[model samples]
Target: MRRSFAFKCTLLVIGWLLVAIAAVQIPARTFWPAAFVALTLPVALGLNLAAALYWLLRNWRVAALPALVAVLTWPHFQRGLAVHPLHLAGAAPKATAGQRVRVLSANVRIFNVYPQLREKDPASPDKMIRWVASNPADVICLQEFYNEPRPSRHDGRLFQSVDRIGEQTGRQVFLSRTLTNSIGAEFGMAIFSRFPIVRRGTITFDKLTQNHAMFADLRLPSGDTIRVFNFHLQSMSMDEKDIVDSYSSKAGLKAKGLGLLRRFKRGMVARSVQMDTLMRRFEKSPYPLLLCADLNDLPYSYSYDQLADHFQNAWATVGTGVGSTYNGALPFVRIDNQFVGPQWVVDDFRVHYEVPYSDHFPTTAEYRLK
Candidate 1:
C-alpha cells in the first residue's frame, strides 16, 4: 500500500510538470506562462529527486516520471547554460593597422533615469563618461544618449551635462532621436567618431510604434568607407496586463476551462506580425554592415538565429569570460550584441559591466577588414 501511494503521488507530480512545460507554447499574452514555467522547472527537478528517494525506499518503477520531467525542462536548462559571451575564435582574417577599425556600442539607459531599478547605479553615468573619455574608440555608438534641456528650478541642466562628453573626448556627436522636448533636450541614439562621418541616415520601422536604425558612413584614416549600423529592436512589451493574464495566474486556470483559446490565438498572431516586420527591415540593408544594438534576445532564440543568417556575431570571435551585458538585478541574460558581415574580421570584444550607467553593460569590439 505504501509503495502504491508513493507511485501515484510521483505520477501526479509528473503530470503537473508536463502541464507547465506546455504552457510556454500556449497562446496567451500574460506573464503567467513564463512565471509558472520558471517556478515549476525547479519543482520538477525536486520531484525527480523525490522519485529517486522513493526508488531507494521501495524499488518502484515510478522513478522514471521525475527523470522524464527533467528531460522536458531541457530548453530552460540550455537557456541558463548559454548566457555567457561567446567568442568566435579564429574567425577574423589578418589586416594591417590602417585596415582595422575599433567600434564600441553601448545602451547607456538614458544615463540611469530609472534609478529605482537594480542595475542603475548612482555613479554609473560619470563612470561611463570617464571610461569613454579614456578609451578613445574610433567609432562609438550610443543608445540612450542624452542632451540637456533648459535649466529647471532646482537643477540648472538635467541632461545638458552629457553634451560635454563628445567635446571632452574630441569626437563629433550626432543624435538619432530625441527623448524629451523640454529645453530642447533629447536622448536617443548617437554616434561619436574620431574619423569623419562621410554620410549618415536613419531607417524607421512602422509597427504602431517607433523603432529605428541609425547608419553612419565612416571614412577611416585609411580612406576606406565602412558603413556602421546601430539600432535597438522592439521590446517584448511584456506589460502588466500580460503578466496578470498569463497562464500561471489564477485567472489563467479559469480561462483554460472557458474561452481562453481565442485570447491565446490573438496574442500569438500579434507577436508573429511584429517579428516579421522587424526582420524585413533587417534583410534590406545594402552595405557591408557592422550592426550593434540591444537585441533583447538570446543567442539560441529565433531572433538571434534570423539575424545571424546575414551577419556573424562578433562576441563569438574574441570575447572571453561571462559576456552577459545586462547588469540588472537578475544578471543572467545577454541581450546586447554586435553582428558583423563577411567584409570584416572580429579581432576582440569585451562587455563593460563595471560601468553601469544603463540597464545594459556596454559591448565593444575591434574589427579588421577581410
Candidate 2:
C-alpha cells in the first residue's frame, strides 16, 4: 500500500512539472518560455538520476516517473544550448594574419533622442565620431545613418561629417540609401573603406518593419574582390493596441493567453520571411562575402543557425569574455555580429560599450584574407 502511495506521489510531481512547462508556452513569451524549458531540463534529468538511486535502494517502480521526465525534457535542453556561447566559439575557424582587414560595425540608433544618455552634452556624438576617426579599420559600416529631411543646418551634412572623417583617415565612404524619406531625414546603411570600392548596391527585404541590406564590393590589397553586406533585420514592434490589450490588467487569463499566441506566431512568421529574403541575397552574391548586422535574434535562434551555415562568426574566433553589444540598462546579449566567409581570418574582435553614442554598442573585428 505504501509503495502504491509513493508511486502516486511521484506521478503527481512529474505531472506538476509538465504542467508548469506547458504553461510557459501557453503565455507565448518566446524568450521566457525558451529559457524556462532550457533550465528545467537539466534539473529534471538530475531528479531522474536521484530517483533511480532511490529505486535501487527501496525497489520502487515510482522511479520511472522521473526518468520519463528526463526523456521528455532532453530535447528542450539541447535546443537551448544550441544557441549558447560555447557553440558560437566552436564554430569559428582559426585565423591567419596575411590578409588582415580591420572592420567596425555600429548602429547609430538613427540619431534618435535617448534621454538615458545625456544627449545635450557635446561629448555624446563627439566621442563616437572621434572613435570612428581614430580607429584603424580597413572597412567601417554604420547603420541607422540619418540625414536631415529639410535643409536644416544639422541635417544634410551628416554624410559629409562621416565622409570628412573618412577622408582625414584616408578611408573612402559608401552610404546606401535605405529610407529615402524618413521622419527626421533620409536614413540608411553606410560603409567607409580604406580600400577603394569596386562596386556597390542595396538589397531590400520584405519585412513588417523597414529594414535593408547594403553591399559594397571592395578590392583588397591582395587583388581579391570581397563583398561586404551590412543589414538590419525586422524589429518586434506590434500594434500599440495589441500591446496594451495583452498586458493590461483588464485582460483575463484566456484573453492574454490567446493574444500571446497570436503575437508569437506573427513574430515567428515575420522573422522567417525576412530571413528567407536575406538568405536569397546572400546566395546571389558572387564575391567572397563579409556580412555584418544587428540580427535581432539570439545566438541559438533559427536565424542565427541559418546564417552560421554560410558564414563564420568573427567574435567566436577572436573575441574574449562576455560580448554583449546592446547598451540598455538590462543589456544581457550579443545581438550585433560580424560574419565572414570561409576564406577570411579574424584576428581580433571587440564590443565597444564605453562609447555611448548609440543604444547599440559598436562591434569591431580584424580579419585577414586567406
Model 2 per-residue lDDT tens digits across residues 1-370? 9867866766665665565455333222334354334235335444555665666567745556576666676443332222345434666555545677889998877654334554555456545666777888889888876545344464344434455557678988776765565454556778889888989887676531347778899998888889998888765444435545555566544466576666655554455566777888888888888988987655544565567657877765555544778776543566788999887776667787777677789988877788
TM-score of model 1 relative to the true fold?
0.64
lDDT of 1 by residue, 1-370 (tens): 9778877887777776666555544323344344334335446545766776767566645556565556665444433242233334544454564377788888876666445732535665556666765675788887767666456564354345445567666777667874566557676788888878888877666521224578888777766777787777655444334434555678765855244444434434444344455566556656567788776555534445456556777765455443688765444568788888888877777787677666678878888876
Instruction: List the global CA lDDT of all models.
Output: 0.63, 0.66
lDDT of 1 at 256: 52
Report the number of the highest-lDDT candidate. 2
The residue pairs that clash in candidate 2, if any, are: 83-300, 99-368, 99-369, 100-368, 101-367
